[model samples]
Target chain A: MLKIENVTVKSEDKVILENFHLEIQPGEIHALMGQNGAGKSTIAKVLLRDSHYDVQGMISFHNKDLLAMNTTDVAREGMFLVMQNPIEIAGVSNAELLRTALNDRGKNTGNILEFHRELTEYCKRLELPTSFVHRDVNFNMSGGEKKKNELLHLWMLKPNFLILDEIDSGLDVDSLKLVARSLVEYYEAYHPSILVITHQKTLLDILKPQFVHVLKDKHIIKSGDFSLAEQIFQDGFGASTMRNGETNE
Target chain B: MNRIIVEQEEVFLQDESVFFTEIPNSLVLHVKGNVCLALTSIHHMEVYLEKGSHFLLEAFVFMKNQTSKIVFHNEDDVVLDFHLSCLYEGENTLEVNSLVDKERVRNYIRVRSVERFGSLLIKATGEILENTRDAFYLEDIQSLTTHQERVKIIPNLLVSSNEAICNHNATITHVREEELFYLRGLGIEEEKATQLIKDGFLKSILQIEEIKK
Candidate 1:
């Protein structure tokens, strides 16, 4: 479970997220939908303490202050953010990274052979070739491949909370299905809470998120079930005209 | 700190012979005649190749004061490929110079070096003689430095031939911040992440496919 209360994020002289708030319960999948530049990804960046922003307000994970934690420390506390544009890192292989992550989290107990076997099986489930295991992380990978690689990390890290930032943007139809199925399977098996940020209805249709929150004007302006997402798809975020937790705009 | 002179000439062969040896100190080798040779070592060596010949050289060495000067002369057709991997620690200067003389012949030269460490100066020069037709040269130097230790890498290509194709590129970089962030985001601690990046940087250069096992 994660909670953000009246968080305001600013960079230099510009306000990115003002009075932004979000809360996710355990085993609940929440979708954050917004137009471009609506501070959807900014929430994820703030949670990770990306260091580029100046943040105010309280962000807590399981009653502990998440805002006070460093990025790696927050990750060690079982938070994983699937970045919008996964970085390309040359010379670091996927297997090496996965092993380091697993080992650091004390999930893999130095059994490299067992880890490799498990990773290969996960790659198969994700419809990725095992050769990707040895290749550098996201180096020269297609956009869909990069998304799948993020899912691979999810499978390997198995965090308590997963934040996916525009994870459906560049995926092809099949890759979208694969990613959706992986997300559902991961949730079903691990019961980790998820916050999916997107503007795609196709992705929402796959994951079937329980709660859909519309991010607008630097805050969550509307919250409802999946129908709200469908309504937004039909009408638009502009049609809401509702302020945060208020009936009137 | 000793030196050795190795000279060979008047030998004509058509098959490829490989010498895989590690020599300490410094060496000067003069090789001539018509032959195709492959030499793999971890020491300083100045080699001269004459007549129509093809030579392949490989040096996988951790440096502690090493220097080399190599020259090639071809009246017919000659090819040279040099691959080096170096690791520098503390303070050191490694200088290497290469010259190719092309006279009515076809020549190919390629030098690839991957150097890592701090407080090191790597000077590499490649030159092609004038009136040389159909000569090509490539020089690639990469440097990885950590800490405040300084790295000065100079890769020079001097081509005087009108019919020569030469390229020289040098890049000196610390560990990239984005790369470090990507690793740390996966929960890898800082020091371990740096070591992993360094390992990857070094191993990526070895283009070996098959193991002799």
Candidate 2:
């Protein structure tokens, strides 16, 4: 339910992405693989309208003009980006941030008791401590804990469009499994569209994306099925991108 | 554990936890045991800790076009834990001086993030007298303001003791853009996001949580 066409993004007078294009139908999972500085994460930032980049393109979400809207509006329209590194907020508790967001999105947060129960249940499901609800957002958590904390927000906000940027990075084996399973459960429950940007095969082996696209030279170069991801992991991006000479068409 | 009005003389406090809403005109304090003071506002004040004392002070300052100087004198076996949080709007100057003149004295001064709107000049000086054995001192000042040029922090450390340990740090920064992006990406408006970040920074003063960078 998302379409991006002929998008060119530039930051600080430097061209980062040139005519980048990708599209995803409803309930489809797409994996984007790229090497360092291939502009894979730039796509997510541009889609969220970071305003640092000079963007020229047309992006539509559910037939709505995505590029015209601001970051908050894009988020309000069911778009979410799990950043590569979650920032630490010193005193803002997760509960407060979540509650404010839920209320701003017109969700019924009036039932305080129900809200507390839902948060507690989510914590238990995610294997996080119940005290994390009141703790500051990613204040002093480990790498694994920070990822789980982002997942907690994921479950609470319930965004239908998720751009997973290195969601598996810095995760231990067990936390990776937990995160993968939680994502699977969320997908099964809501069937949201996912554009996962990753290099590892562990998460892809579980999520099993329907489409896999390789990014190079500021644009997507190849589009394949889950096998492409396995092939890239088995070999490398240099070898995999060379195999498919055709651009994503 | 008691709240008493400070007279213009030496008040010896033993095992007392006090909350000073406003600093009196003048006074000298002596702590016999562990003592704590939570001051909401401060002015031109001088505090002296007699020999063999422990003190912890948390002060919050919100000022506009005001100047304040606070001096502290520490004696032998005296420990001082000082935390100051400032929010300046128009213009202000705050200077804090701590004198560790005796043996085995420890001083910790933390100027928690100074939120500035117009201008602010913050100076923190730590002086360790000569021949003092095992004198430890540290001062850290941080400022968060969009007007980086308007906010200035001068951390001065003067130590004459050869066996003393003294350290100072200073930082000035504006609201982090990446942080705002993360918050706005969660559907919170920009205005609300900025406010939340500012509020969190100020309130973090009272919390002793470790930050994992």
Candidate 3:
């Protein structure tokens, strides 16, 4: 369960997000649709406590003050954000990072052999090579491979809450289907809460979020079921949004 | 592929290794064959590579109270790949002079130095003589230091051959904040994350994979 109440985020002297609010219950998947630069990804960054932004108002994750927690603590508290553009870090292998992260969270990975087996299995399921385990994190990888690599981390970390920021972008049709199917399977197994930010109806068609919220003017202006997403797909965000007493006119 | 322990003051190396063997004070070596050489515990050393030989040199340096220099002489068709990893905590100057007067030679030098205290001065020079055709040389150096500890990198490429290719680059940086944020976002603590970044930096700068094998 996560709650955002009248959250205001600012960068330097400029305000990037104002009076933004959303709430997600356990096992609920919410799709946040917005135009370009409508502060959708800003919410994800602010939730992860990216030090660049100045945040105000209240954000509670599992009834704890989320804004007070640092990025590491937020991750330890079962919060994971898959950024639109994953960073490329050279020389730090994926296995090394995953092991360190699990150890820091006080989660034992059983034994070395078991951990290697599990990681290799995940790589196979994701259609990535086993050698990726030793390769640097996201370095020199293709765009589609970077997306799948994030999903690999998702499987490894197994967080309770996920903020998926444009995970479907740069993925082929088959890769998108694979990613969506993986998310559905994860949902069925763990019943984790998810916030998916996207403009693609194909991803929404597969995951089938319970609610759809359109972000505009720095806050959620409309909330509806999957039909709203379908309506936007048929028309556009402008036709679906009611801005300034008009349909986003 | 032969391993050699440097017991004498001078030796001729042809397919022999001196890894984990500290040189006594100083030594002179005539090198041949394709080899991975690690110069250890030597304040001053001289190396002569045979014509048409390939050599890979790796060294992780930590010294105090004295300076160190390694001078290299290259014959025709010789290939030299040098990786120098340095950790400095006191005033030290390390110089690597590669003298080349040969045709169809390649010399690549990479230096990675981290200054935790005091200061470090790295001078890497590649001198190519005239009429040396089809020669190429690269000098890349990266250093990390805080405000109190200073690091200076000097890459000297004195090439007299018009038909030679030469490149020199140097980068000095402190710990980057964005990289730290990325690691911390994955639940790694700040201190450990910093250490990981530094370790990664050191590992990547080596660029000599076959040497480890």
Docking class of 2: medium
Candidate 2: chain B TM-score against the reference chain B:
0.86
Model 1, range B131-151, lDDT digits (tens) per residue? 577777777777776653487
At residue A46, give the lDDT of candidate 2: 88
Lowest lDDT block of 10, candidate 1 chain A: A240-249
* Clashes within 3 Å, all models in order: 0, 1, 0
Model 2 error, position A54 (Å): 2.4
Q: Candidate 3's fnat?
A: 0.66
Q: Model 3, residue B25: displacement in angstroms?
A: 3.6
Every candidate's CA RMSD: 4.5, 3.7, 3.5
Cα error of candidate 1 at position A222, Å: 2.8
Per-model i-RMS: 1.3, 0.7, 1.0
Candidate 1 local lDDT, A40-61, one digit each (tens): 8888878877888999999999
Model 2 clashing residue pairs (backbone): B1-B17
| DockQ of candidate 3, scored on C-alphas against the true complex (2 decimals) | 0.66
The pairs that clash in candidate 3 are none
lDDT of 2 by residue, B1-213 (tens): 455555455566677788765456455665666778777776777787878888888778787788888899888898988888888778888999998778999998888755545788999888877868898898988887766789888888888889898999898878898989999999999878877887788777557523411
- Overall lDDT per candidate, in order of appearance: 0.74, 0.86, 0.84
Q: Write the per-residue lDDT of candidate 2 for residues A121-233, one digit (tens) a residue.
A: 99999999999999899999999999999999999999999999999999999999999999999999999999999988899999999999999888888889998998899
Error of 1 at A156 (Å): 1.7
